[model samples]
Target chain A: MNKELVEKIKNDPNYQELVSKRSSFSIKLTIAMLAVYFAFILTIAFKPALLGTPLSADSVTTVGIPVGIAVIIFAFILTGIYTKRANTEFDDLTNKIKNAIKEH
Target chain B: MNRTFLFLVLGSIAVFASGAIEGEVQKQALNMSAIVMFLIFVSATLGITYWAAKRTKSAKDFYTAGGGITGFQNGMAIAGDYMSAASFLGISGLVYMKGYDGLIYSIGFLVGWPIILFMIAEPLRNLGKYTFADVASYRLRQTPIRTLAASGSIATVVLYLIAQMVGAGKLIELLFGLNYEVAVILVGVLMILYVTFGGMLATTWVQIIKAFLLLSGASFMAIAVMAHYDFSFGALFTHATELKGIAIMSPGGLVSDPISAISLAIALMFGTAGLPHILMRFFTVSDAKEARKSVFYATGFIGYFYILTFIIGFGAIVMVFKNPAYLDVVKNAVDGTSPILGGSNMAAIHLSHAVGGDFFLGFISAVAFATILAVVSGLTLAGASAISHDLYASVIKRGNVDSMKEMRVSKIATVILGIVAIIMGIMFEKQNIAFVVGLAFAIAASANFPILVLSMYWRKLTTRGAVVGGSLGLATAILLVILSPTVWVKILGYKTAIFPYEHPALFSVAVAFIAIWFFSITDKSENAKEEQEAFEAQYIRSQTGIGAEGASH
Candidate 1:
């Protein structure tokens, strides 16, 4: 690690803002990850019997796969939402502070 | 000895010859309509490039469109970039061929948008300038931290570019019977040009334009699906069941094994969130609010796209039943190697042809071609940025720079990276193409996301902790992927799979998280108190930028 980055890290308002932006990700990350996880589980647990397979993409696998896949996908979505929000809010605040410090 | 072998040798020679040839030929597909389309595309591209070139007076504008793009536009651009040839052709084909299984990819992918909206969009937007490296290095040392982020970004971008490049080749071969190498190089050059001249502004506009077309095209087809079935989903479902002979709609159509389903889902959700090209989308927006809006719009648009994909996929099942396109690759294909691409991409193409004819086929094909080009351009640019900007400028130069000089380096980097992609594309022309994307997702989930999340949230996440943890995660994820059965055995023609775990996401994600937490805790820092105070003050300010409700700071 370079000395300058450490110095910048110490002074960076945006970095601090990003660091605090963690609370938002923490709130939604667990549930979104879990929702996808649980959805996958429930889908597998109860592969409910439907009439003739609805015109599928092609093959007739268990209902668990697509739904499970969907759920797993949800995890990333949840995480992305968290990161994007955190970065923005954090940066704006940091920028403001930096501006203030510059004024002083 | 065999006809197949004879054809393969001939095909290889033809590919080699074309790759050597610098001049253009009278490609039949490049007819009058195509000429017009290319004019429009090229004009649009060059126009954006010139504009971007002019506006790129500083490094800031060159890398991030001057951070002026609205979140909604950025979101749309993300959608444009994210909805690649894979999403357009592959998912549709998957849904067309696999039925409910295909929906897994679609829903999983689109679902991540809403997650982006609610969770990470704004914070990420407000947190960084230009690149993700800026975000990570904000709190950490530049050398190791920038190196890790740059490497991770590079890995993601290259893997992603390869995937897009592969898709371009496959689509070209399918649409035009040119050999795969020709297809790859053709698209590769087009992509290089797209990025070389235009930069971010051009790329953004291309994406915005393409996104609207893709969604509208899907929308048109979706309407056709409803009209075909009298707009009754029940009728559509019933018809689908009759065609499938199994319960396609009611849960059982998901997977053969339930656990496989669970694991697969875990891979995709985490995977989507962490993707390099996708995560980079958050950086494009000017503010958090717009980022949020972009995600919401993308989710809504994509939700419709997913639903339409289902309809279209199912339509193929019915269409193929009535008219077997190639009668299942075995009876139709010259060999067993290539997939029967007659499923989703072909279905939509076929539907367009059926409804309109040569004009329509050419239009959709043009759109598909442009779709792949636009995506490959973005992926290549991101990769080049990771290398030039993140690695060279930020890490190598320690974020110290003259504006114009750094931007020039980035341009040179872009050219170099583009050439590399072209070489790789030509070399790996015939391998299973879409799998390139799966590998990309694996890298993203395992390498980038962990460090990004932990750095922002964990106060104890010291520079050493971030550097070590980030590298470990990146190395572990990439190494696992490199050794996985897909690459080691299948692609490399190796005898056996080296690693026990096929999917890196499951293990890599956990390892990265543990490493971050462990390193952050074990080392108590002298700078910790000052860092804490600064971080708290920054947080209060950031909270102000969160929507009005969140402005309660």
Candidate 2:
């Protein structure tokens, strides 16, 4: 890209907003994922029995099964949430930044 | 096209001749249905390759399928690449043996997708052209950065290829009653043809088809198992617990300590992001939006596939365990405990026959072999790209090479990689290759991921810092794995390992980041300053997709 166009986009508020909003959003989502995963990993590491406990007194199903499946589902859901926001909100700001540079 | 057909015929004939010679010694009945299904899959993929070869006219098409794949198709392809035979048979086999412990791997592998989607996918699509080295070397010195990235990529690819090839040989031997050497040669030749002739387009389609078949077959197995239990997991678990005790419902011996667990978790998560084949899929899509959508779909398919594998594992425990028909009676008599035919890794395969009968078993076997072929093809293509694109065209020719020559170089690299994979697969046939995959994940997490992420986000990442830090991470990962228990004690017959843990990502990744930070900040060179100044433009393009490759199209 040309230096002038890059400078214009860099100084544009839309670009700034897009960058900040998207980065923070991604960082937040990433932390959420890491927190969830690490929590499970720590549980597997430290207290295996906690996840080993059955769902009910008479149940053969353990707590870990649901928790593990939930983690997998949680990952998919987070990706969905991010894709939705990125394709709509983030793309809008990007297009606005592009338009501003073109107008200049 | 005629040469391609001739090559395929010769390869199949060689495989059959070897299989026949080995069959006499083994005295194993050939699985005709499995052989037929495998032949069908091979012919179909070869057909796709012929079509793809006609369309693969440029270096662009050779690498990223001319950036024409849709989000959903790319998503399936990514899932195909991720859900290899290792994950399918390996993870399910773990579950069948250890129960809940297998889910740990499934979860570790699945969790990487969200992080990739949030952090790497869009920037990778915007900044890269063919390989991830494109993105990593965006503002850094091309030669050093490309060399480092390509080394890491090739290392990761070859290690992963060896594991997949070994697993394929073993699985095919048990599933199709084929000879191990024949299976390896078949995989090697087919993979070389797909990649050299068809390139990314053929490889992607093969993965998509294999992913579909694998998902459908596993889904059928899981559903059949559930149906036997009235669609209640509680019933399946109840029966499994009754047969194998309640320990099957809980964690066994997969992860014994905290450090190992965390280290392994780190490797599995970040390793997915650093994988050249998986990362290369981002460029297969048209734009950032498609990239984002692809990850969404990929995560869903992969996550769901893991769930199915988990179910299949539990189902095997319920249905295949202690079943006299599936058990090797002579081995069980000697061992005093019933062992399933072909080891625990064949748990899901045996479960297919138990639940869905011989025809389904044949289908699953074909799908399993197809999965191996697709994964190895992708790995060879990625390795070839690392050699041809990063090392040859960029580093050697200094970006002056023509596209046609680059394509030829890649095809040559593909054939060499295929041969190496076959040789290594045969050599490691009797060795414990489970750690090889773990080592691949560690190298990727520690080496490729840190440099790629730092180059994009860290403003001070110079060529010196990247090369030094990346090479250190790569070396550390390899060295530590050698010293770790899996290699040192298990493979090398050492008394005790110097390193207590089996995984080195937690330490090696930290070392890489710290070294990169230290070296980058300490370097006050004019080149370093220029790189830092150039980051703004790179970041702008990364975020906004301005001047991104294939963006105009």
Across B293-352, the per-residue lDDT of candidate 1 in tens digits comes to 677666655666666767776765655444544344553456533333343345566655
Deviating ranges (above 4 Å) for candidate 2 = B1-27, B551-553
User: Candidate 2 lDDT, tens digit per residue, B1-553?
Assistant: 0111111111111221111111112224688888899999999999999999999999999999999899999999999988877678777877887788778767877888998988899899999999999999999999989999999999999888887777677677777778889989999999999999999999999999999999899888888888898999898898888888888777666665677777777887888899998999898889999999999999999999999999999998888889887887777889967877766767888898898787888898899889888888988999999999999999999999999999999999999999999999899777665467677878889999999998889898988888888988988999998897667886799999898776788999998998888889998999999999999999999999988877223
Model 1 spans with C-alpha error above 4 angstroms: A1-33, A40-42, A45-104, B1-39, B177-179, B250-263, B324-345, B432-435, B488-501, B525-534, B545-553
Q: What docking class should model 1 receive?
A: incorrect
> What TM value does the first chain of each candidate achieve?
0.50, 0.96
Cα lDDT listed for each candidate: 0.61, 0.85
- Per-residue error at B53 for model 2, in Å? 0.9
Residues A1-104 of candidate 1 have per-residue lDDT tens digits of 23443455446656555545555455556565567545544443344342223235554444444454455345445544554654566446646655654564
